[model samples]
Target: MDRALELAARGPAHGPNPRVGCVILAPATPGIPGRTVLGEGWHRGAGTPHAEVAALADARARGHDTRGATAVVTLEPCHHTGRTGPCTRALLDAGITDVVHALADPGVTSGGGADHLRAHGVHVTAGPRSAAALDLVHTWHHAVTTGRPWITLKTATSLDGRVAASDGTSQWITGPQARAHAHAIRAQVDAIAVTTGTALADDPALTARTPTGTLAPHQPLRVVIGHRDLPADHRLLHDGPPPLHLRTHDVGDVLAALHHHEIRHLLVEGGPALAGALLAADVVDELHAYIAPVLLGDGPPAIPPYGITTLATAPRWHTTTTHRLGDDILLIARRTATHPDPDTEEA
Candidate 1:
């Protein structure tokens, strides 16, 4: 399973599909304590060959007999055919004797793969190293379970929690290292989002540029919200991928539109007005904040007041990670709990 996890880590970092790994073990040799590993493979992304089929093909190409071999995989072998054929059929065709899977597929279109394999006389064991598999697909699972994209709200602020100086001179708040880290986050998500206020003030290109000022190949879709017209020459309008202008104040509508575009994860990098609205709607899943060691006594807050009347009324977040980027500290947090049902909530 550890090998499977390692292989799964090789999958793409920016996509809606879950990362999955597979290893095929041939019949044990006389002196070997365990079966010999014949092949290994991991799923790259959606519309690609699944892990099981890849591993089976690799083993066959090596002239390894796959009959009665054991297949260890990170995710439950898929049963239905969508972008690719069912993995269960692949395993059966390869004459797999036993199958060990880490996590079950909870997707509406792809669950029950284990049951189908079991009914077909394959020995299927579930939940070995399940935590690792679950971790790899957390964002994808959240996006699939809820009809919304997983939002990661990123803000760079001063030590006093101000986003900018009093006079609105906010360029280069963080150092070069921190800015690079922010661009890395931008590169990982399916889309980078902002509000009308930010579009008018910053005129950001919203492209995931590298340290050398070159654009990354996997540029996220640029998303601008609110009913406002952008200048024709704006970089976001003509720089990289075609920008998505959502002329709506409704957060749900914005997310629904993104979901329809197959955007599983989004990075929200906008002003306090947009951040406050997303927080109030309880739609944000993660918060990524970068705090420089400088103090801005009086300036725009990183996040506007959320109308919390008392301490108990305030939203709670649990720290997931913290680190330093140059002189700035990066903090990642997740809400204690998501609202039971967010579809009925107002934006």
Candidate 2:
């Protein structure tokens, strides 16, 4: 399962297809007790060997024989041909007898990889950490299957769910730890998107800032969504490390453009209206909310006015995980499969 999580972590960055991670487990040697993780491999970048092939190479280099090793991966091995050879064939060539995957591939070109492996005489098991693993690459899977970009709504707010002061003065509401964590999330996405209100009000740069010596460099595309024409002096419009741009209104148009650019993962940062609009459009696939410990009783609300006339019209989502980012609480959610039955009360 850890291997699958690792693969999911590689998503939003791996191009063309979401990256996957693989771990090969073999029997312990004389001095070793039980099974040992003989090798680990991750999709390097575009135009590189797939995860399973890379794992095979790593195992061979480590002097670990794969006569009957078990392969654990985040997604089912690809059965169809692609930039590289079929991962199923690679596992068979490596003499791997068993395979465990978190989830089956959902791509039209690559679905049923598990069934193909089973037919090839490899023991296969699915549904181990499948949901969590799928969450990592949800955007990628959604794009492949539905022809749209994966959208993640990101927000940082006070413990009381305020994003700014009553007068709309919001600058660094969260502590350094929470802010830094937000940057890390930004670095993982293919694009960092913000609304026009946020741009006009906050004038945020929306770029990921890493600590002085972190090896992984952040270079996500900067996107601003709204109808307002941004001034040339806007900080985000200038040439810099990561590319920047302004996307016009019409969520569907913006999504189509993103898909054309091969951007499967998106991070939506906002001042309320933006988030509310995406939620209202029923286009948001995921949510990442960072709640700080402090509160501002008369500050800006976490969500902008959704403009829904009644409670029945409100959008409903499912909470997936809640974790701590320093003193702040992080809440992750996914849009429910269907709009809530109006008669059902929200928990």
Give TM per candidate. 0.93, 0.74
Worst 10 residues of 2 by lDDT: 238-247
> Candidate 2 vs. truth: CA RMSD?
4.9
C-alpha local distance difference test of each model: 0.88, 0.78
User: Candidate 2 lDDT, tens digit per residue, 1-347?
Assistant: 68546754763464567768888999446776767888888776667887788888999999989988999888889987877888988999999999998878987787878888788898999888888777666768888888887888888888788988788767677767777777887777788788777787777777777855242475678887777777777777664654445457777888888887878888888757778877778888888988888778987787866677886657678999997867887899987866755575689
What overall lDDT, based on C-alpha atoms, would model 2 receive against the true structure? 0.78
Worst 10 residues of 1 by lDDT: 337-346
**Inter-residue clash pairs, candidate 2:** none
